[model samples]
Target: MIDKIAWLHLVDGRILSTRSRGKDVYYLPGGKREAGETDAQTLVREVREELTVTIELSSIEPAGVFEAQADGKAAGIVVRMTCFTAEYTGTLAASSEIDELAWLGYADRDRVSAVDKLIFDHLHEAGQLS
Candidate 1:
């Protein structure tokens, strides 16, 4: 299966997350890739479109890759989340299809998806989350 990767920014000890317009759960502020787009390109474009901020491509560093059952999809659906922590410019505002923005901690994992739970686990294990 093809993996979906995203660059997630952790700021001030909180991870940046978003919710879709009609969705109740929060998700990491990134999206799926387009054909022919490199991982860096996909990350930059997805983050910009969702958060209305320009992430410095050079500043982004690989955090981890997480996999889990895809949310609201078929049984075999799996997502590969390529995460990153980066410095960005511009105010973080909800743009495009994002309805709200949130800074979530490990305690908020229950409110996220299975894939995001794996991300939280990685962050906690790596001492990035408290």
Candidate 2:
């Protein structure tokens, strides 16, 4: 299993997502947690690296945990995504491995990875997403 962290940045009922360089699908902003890092620390650093915006650590909150088959990977390989919502600083701009940025609603499920689709569904069900 591959474990990851994700930021649930919702704006106007849409969520912020990123497409990494060479990847076809978009994903929730954030990445793998480094060894010895707390989830908040991982989120702050990963969001800064991927979105060029620093997540306000104190504002971070647990959104949900999701898992799915890893896209384009070996059978049985799964990605466990721990998600969060938080305030952040700086304008969002793609950086590092990120190649594209998008604000997605529930209608955009087909555009993201499986675990991200689950997040969208959850947010939509809670009326926090479109």
Candidate 3:
């Protein structure tokens, strides 16, 4: 399993997602944890690197975890995504390898990665995403 972390930011029934350059699918905003880094530390650094925002460490909360076949990988390869919700400071924008940023809703489910699609379904079921 490829372990990863993700930031789940929802606004008005849509979730924040990013598309890396040259990729066709969107993914939640976060990445793998560095050596010896806690989830919070990884989250703060990844969010800052990918979205140019500062995640309010105190506001971090576990959202949910989801796993699925890693996109574009060999069959049986899996990605385990640990998700979180937190308040942030700064305007959201594409940074680093991100080519575009989108606010995706359930209707856009087909545009995200397998793990992210699971997250979308969960949020939709909870009535947090439309």
Candidate 4:
């Protein structure tokens, strides 16, 4: 199983998230890996396209890894999401393929993916949620 990683930003106690067009659930603002792309490369490009920001990769800190059943896939098709927190530049706005951008709190967990729910749980347990 290939694990995908992304850098997430928590600003003013709100977690950054995005939703693709016609998608019901909000997701962490990131994307999948391109062929032969490194984790950092995938993260950098995905965040830029989804959130319109430049992630300071050097400032990235591992947060947690989450696993869940892949959406629209059969059982055992799991998605491994390795999460990170980092400092970044530029004002965040929905861009490229993102249809909506949001800042969600713990109470909004049900609106996100299963893996993201784990992320919120971890953040909440660690007193990181605002």
- Model 4 alpha-carbon miss at residue 64, Å: 1.6
Error (Å) of candidate 2 at residue 108 is 0.8
Model 4: weakest 10-residue lDDT segment is 1-10
* lDDT value, residue 58 of candidate 1: 88
Measured against the true structure, the TM-scores of the candidates, in listed sequence, are 0.93, 0.96, 0.98, 0.92
Q: Candidate 4 lDDT, tens digit per residue, 72-91? A: 67778888998877888998
User: Weakest 10 consecutive residues, lDDT, candidate 3?
Assistant: 90-99
| Local accuracy of candidate 3 as per-residue lDDT tens digits, 55-123 | 999999999889999999999999999999999999998896899999989999999999998999999
Candidates sorted on lDDT, descending: 3, 2, 1, 4
lDDT of 2 by residue, 4-63 (tens): 999898999999889999999998888898989999999999999988888887898998
Q: Better model by lDDT, 1 or 4?
A: 1
* Model 3 bad stretches (over 4 Å): none
Residue lDDT tens for model 1, 11-130: 666788899999988889777889999888888898889888998988988878888888888899888888877888999999969989988999998989888998888887887766
Residue-pair clashes per prediction, in order, are 0, 0, 0, 0
* Model 3 root mean square deviation, Cα atoms: 0.6
2 versus 4: better TM-score goes to: 2
Q: Give the per-residue Cα lDDT of candidate 2 at 104.
A: 84
